[model samples]
Target: MNLIFHVRSERRVTFHPYSSLNDYIDHACCFHCRDGDWWLAKSLLTGDEGFIPCTFVAKAHSLEVERWFFKDLSRRETERLLVAPANKPGSFLIRESETTKGALSLSIRDLVAEEGDVVKHYKIRCLDNGGYYISPSITFSTLQELVKYYTRTADGLCQRLNAPCKAMLPQQPWAQDEWEIPRSTLKMMERLGAGQFGEVWMGYYKGRQKVAIKTLKEGTMEPAAFLQEANLMKKLKHDRLVHLHAVVTMEPILIVTEFMCNGCLLDFLKTEEGRKLKIPKLIDMSGQVAEGMAYIEGKNYIHRDLRAANILVNEMLHCKIADFGLARIIETEYKAQEGAKFPIKWTAPEAINYGTFTIKSDVWSFGILLTEIVTYGRIPYPGMTNPEVIRQLDQFYRMPCPEGCPEQLYDLMMGCWKEKPEERPTFEHLQHTLNDFFIATEGAYEMQP
Candidate 1:
């Protein structure tokens, strides 16, 4: 069975049987399967068949890709969809009729493939009018191509996919890489936290390896977006950054990472053990966060949301930056999203007024995080609503330095909250300053008579 798939990237495929000059220059082909590293298929565009590489294409989900023509369906609803347009059979009879625009939908769950001697199939359907149809018989692998055939012009689907011309994928396909641990290997344990995106659970991998399991909230996000974020997170590595161990995409999407025993920094600080932490210890925690931020800054990434609640602490008192679900990669700068939500209390003045976000804005949030640490998890801009905090900041009001916070550290916080983005210190500078404070405090303790 030949199922429809879409080209994810542009590539030059070779025609082995017919090696004419014309065929070599513009051989067009839709993907079939892995003939080792090459594709074996035919192209509807040129009626030419050839071998393209696996990197050029990906399977497209029918509902999402065929939005212009088809809708999702369950088996029970198929008859209803076909008969809905007509009060009786005579007026809108779509089956075996011609020269009419009566459209009908069908839901089918047919066995489509065999993987390692196991047959599998996906639920799919098509939409059709009495005369014309939108299905595999139309001879287009993607909706973009199908639309182009009808209109004799490019359509929005082509623009939306934005297939790159170059082979921009990583050398190793993510599925076959070392990190792709089988879903069977993970055992779900106690629930840790719950949020809009998903739930976090303490889990065990391979019976002994403890890990944090984050499952995507059902129907909350598209599979493609979730997988994209997972891919990005797996590429990043650092001692102070949460390490992704594996991802399970079989049924309920799950992301496994190092389990931070101490939980979020804010909650940890509120605990009895947290209350006993001295200033030097707090500084160390902040320093670890800065080191992580430094790595992210150097990589030209923006963590849009950076607050104490997003920082995870381990049993060793090590802080690791977590929750990159909202993270974005920016080359030089990024424009603000039209309706993006942000934590107002921790947000910088510029990020609030304008929609611009930069590493400097993250610096502003880090300053607020410092307050959370110093105050032993006190909420920033306490006693003020979100709008009130914005108004106060506009009037040059700042949070009072947390009690017992050293003068040097408070001054550093003030610098981070500067109105001008360029005036704020880079994470590298913040890390060094924190190290100095840590060293000075240690020396003073040692000098006590």
Candidate 2:
């Protein structure tokens, strides 16, 4: 079938004869090419013909294209999104049922709901005849049709579907060539660290350029799964993120990335030089991480593990987010395996209690990271055992501001630790806030001199 796809982002054809055509007609729909990542398409506005990257578009008719369709969204996440201060009573979205396979659920925000229950969900049933319905008497041929009907009249629903839950436009993956590197070109050097899966070593790419090579231990993880990390890294290209250079999938699988000479942020912060850095410099470091996370969030990806230990620092004190083994695409459902060990103090309550992870959970971890930053790498909730930390969190207890931490910075951290996930500021918001704070603090320090 010749499936239709819509361009989610504008792409400027900078090279070749196609550059002569109009800059990729905005909001254009196109057909996929038989081979490669190119698409054979015409602009919906100007009918201009050109080739576009397949990664720049999304399936036209897929539910994922709709802002309100949040596939695999958990019940708690839906509640949090709908209860946000900006949403109105009739805002709604459709998500795959968490309890039922091959089934969908409709969640709506209701102004009249009791105090504790502002969002309500209803099961959407599908018939063997390929029709969908929330009530037996209101079957529709497509989900779009059902939504259209509800938009005009509440009928059996709690309220009319006035608007889709606010969300960013979908982001497609990057189109790139194979990244496999010849094993003969690399010269392994000193070991950096060891983990449960494998060890990381300092290596030289092409015998001169520095790089970090992460090797996969045999029988530790499936090769395909390990390669998936490399594939994910390919799409995440940002200056503040550890850049992936190449991979060796041969006998000993290796992932090569840009080397951070200073090593992980946690260890660096505890060093004598690290402790001597002023608060403004620490804020600048934290802002760099926020900037990287903002990019990841915009692309609809979640870094499930966001802690100081996972951040790497360069010789210049610049920080970058590293370690993607626990990252996931927002659209996919993720559940922690039972009995699996998690970083209790660094994890959010919902994730620890129910195995649900979302971008909000990452925000919670960032709050804990702030405590580490101000204390020069002190552990979060020190003197408390894991079980004790959980018990305190259940009582709504939060970590206090570290000594010498600025009042404004502590307040921002508290905002990140809000009990409701929706109340946490997004990475983009946090980035802007921290950037502004850094500038103000730097100015104050200069004035004192």
Candidate 3:
């Protein structure tokens, strides 16, 4: 027989160019040749991005990489390299730009690297279902050459490369809307784990720095909620608050971002390995947290749920507060009116008793947090529930921060813990006070956590 046929898919059939068609399985770079009855196709459509080519070789192979080639990147062409559904540590890619035709070129690698300096090599993982990563060399010379070579290349080459070779999509916003992602981006979402909401994941935004995609978690909440928060967060520019990357509406949800790998402060503080909270680190992080809150407070934002869990810690042990889920503007008494429950001990006595919340209420909460720092995360009243904590608040229960913990911290905590709430220091005052205290202690205090 000249051809093999699926009795059902009898639509069309072609015979093999060679016997068995699978003999050269172990041969590397098999697709460029015709012997294997399979080939590597270049599609800008896959989640792996046009950063790498798709190897359709070794047909009938169960390896996820093999099946991926047959898929399409044409769907959701607007986003090529996804960032959400963050692939496994190893499942993604980055571009290897080289000089071709007196221009730079890029090749995908199997790892997202740590080095992105001019001479360093980097690997980036794809956010889609394709478990692919590109190990790219970060060479300034090569990157420059590629830019010179491809007049169309922008340092900010995003999903636009998948633009049809024939120029099928026009430049207008509406035209770009109907555009289909190229072959490379087609299979990007395949096998990708579902993201928080409709967020699509990608890497290398702004400066190719490692960052994370904040998407809406699927459930009863509308993806719009995430977008709303993302928008609000994007406008918030503070060194201490989590930096917002972009507020993109990927139809189903919005995306918020901050540097990747910097998990929340709770996870960070709990880790005992290779961690040293020099007084500087503590003061810096705590100070930043306070500064961030000050900024939010100026905008009338009340981070109703301020705690270690919402604050992120970078590699430098620098702190940046996040998670505005329970955050709100102080103009209204929304949650208070709804009788929504929140962390009890963290609540100001007024918020709990009088059902009133304001900037001062946030100040009171920060006081408890300052105490949490000295106590290393032990809640003020460890064994009490919200109702029980409320009882304690009524009695003006306060935790006596341990000795050997910085005395200035003790002073700050006590001031913020005042039951009257009016006695709590404002965020700005807290910042300046801490700064002065630290400068004076710089030459003194052993600086222990």
Please report, in order, the local distance difference test score of every candidate based on alpha carbons: 0.64, 0.76, 0.47
- Range of the 10 consecutive residues with the lowest summed lDDT in candidate 1: 115-124
> Residue 254, candidate 3: how far off, in angstroms?
4.9
Clash pairs detected, candidate 1: none
What lDDT tens digits, residue by residue, belong to model 2 across residues 1-449? 55556554444553222433244323646553534555556665666666655545666666666667787677645755675545778999999987778888888887652332267678888989999988787789999998999999988677799998754221112224437878987899999999876889999876756789988787755767767766876789886888777788775788888888789989888999777666756776788789999998888888888999889986556688998867867675467778867799999999999998888888999989988988999999999999999999999999988999999999999999999999999999999898778444322111100
Q: State every prediction's TM-score relative to the real structure.
A: 0.58, 0.58, 0.51
User: How much lDDT does candidate 3 score?
Assistant: 0.47
Best by lDDT: 2
lDDT (Cα, tens digit) per residue for candidate 3, span 1-449? 11111111111112122211221222222233222223322212221101111232333333222211222332111011221122221222222223222221121112223311011122223323433222232222332233232234323332112211110111111111322212221212122124233343434333323345444544625546655664565567675777665444544333435553546665565567213334434555677688788888788777777877667765544567776656665575534756566677777888777777777888888877776665555656777677877777677777766645677787887888777767778898887776455445333211110
Clashes of each: 0, 0, 58
lDDT of 1 at 100: 22
lDDT of 1 by residue, 314-371 (tens): 6556789998877778887777878877889989999899988899999999999999
Stronger candidate by TM-score (1 vs 3): 1
Q: How does model 1 fare in lDDT?
A: 0.64
Ranking under lDDT, best-scoring first?
2, 1, 3
RMSD of each: 25.9, 17.2, 18.5
